[model samples]
Target: MLRSLLPIVEHAVKGPVWDCQMCGQCVLHETGMTCPMTCPKTLRNGPCGGVAVDGACEVKPEMQCVWVKANHRAENLPLLPQSWRDEIGHLRAPVNNSLAGDSSWMNLVSGADRKTPTGWKGSE
Candidate 1:
């Protein structure tokens, strides 16, 4: 199917370079529409001091901070359980390689192998 072939074609032409938005919607929406995975700072309760009055991130001035965006989304939806929100605050995963190498998108489309763990030592 073309879906499966597209990644291979892209990889062949472009190597492994890809862009990631790092939106935690996948984890947030299902659990309670709360995103912890995407936000680099991983703020649960609210936006950190980095948030500008207009709701832009200090780190990436052009972009709306993840926490600011998440807060807005959460406010529109029903209130999420405090425990679920709290749990996300502590959970952190390396956003890039984690998705690129291991995502089901790559698995189904490209049949790419998961990236070797950091500092892995193969036996001779």
Candidate 2:
């Protein structure tokens, strides 16, 4: 009844959210078939303790964890080397606007450059 209709109504209201261009294959093919793009936290290394031993994502228990899927994908690709695992040790936080060369967003959002320091002097 209402429960069955809910899905139809929801789909009509929020259509196309589930559609993906499959461009994500680029991440897999280029990076040892490991997909950091689809991950919610976008972890490139491994699970963030947000998955159970059974490979269920803590954020969404009903769905397979991204890390687990990535591991499986990696296993099948013989050409894919394990070198990426070494690089993960030096993983840095994904840069946002400030570090992505879009400093204007940072300035607008954080007001970082709204005023100069009190003692600062600049040539006119």
Candidate 3:
């Protein structure tokens, strides 16, 4: 019951504002409120090298590069807590496919989202 309902509520609240993709491991607080999962390439850490010189997305030329926007927001967005913005430089772990469609709010509280497969390069 907890798992099933959390996703619906999470999506309903976050979807309209952030266009969240419910990757089951949310890093929006660290990401300047942008949803990295919504990137055309779904890049977790940062933007692809294909970003144009003008800061436009290479995959979707009309839009600004997601990372470019994230960085700007992380620095300039008012009312962002300093601790949440401090992690912008961290290397986000790769997506855990098994957790797709699950509730990230629950995963976050239980620390389930941080579990990497054995031998994963991101594992400590």
Best by the lDDT measure: 3
**Poorly placed runs, candidate 2 (over 4 Å):** 1-31, 81-93, 96-124
Model 1 regions lying over 4 Å from their true place:
1-48, 78-90, 93-98, 105-124
Better of 1 and 3 by lDDT: 3
**TM-score, every prediction:** 0.38, 0.42, 0.92
- Decoy 2 TM-score against native: 0.42
lDDT tens readout by residue for model 3, 6-35 = 999999999999998989999999999998
Candidate 3, lDDT over the whole model: 0.90
TM-score rank, highest first? 3, 2, 1
lDDT for each residue of candidate 2 in 1-124, tens digit (9 for 90 to 100): 6435544554443235432222211223333345454567766556788798789888878877877876676556565666653433333333232222222223445554333456555333
- Candidate 3 Cα deviation (angstroms), residue 52: 0.8
What is residue 8's positional error in candidate 2, in angstroms? 29
Q: Give the winner by TM-score: 1 or 3.
A: 3
Q: Flag regions of model 3 displaced more than 4 Å.
A: 121-124
Name the top TM-score candidate: 3
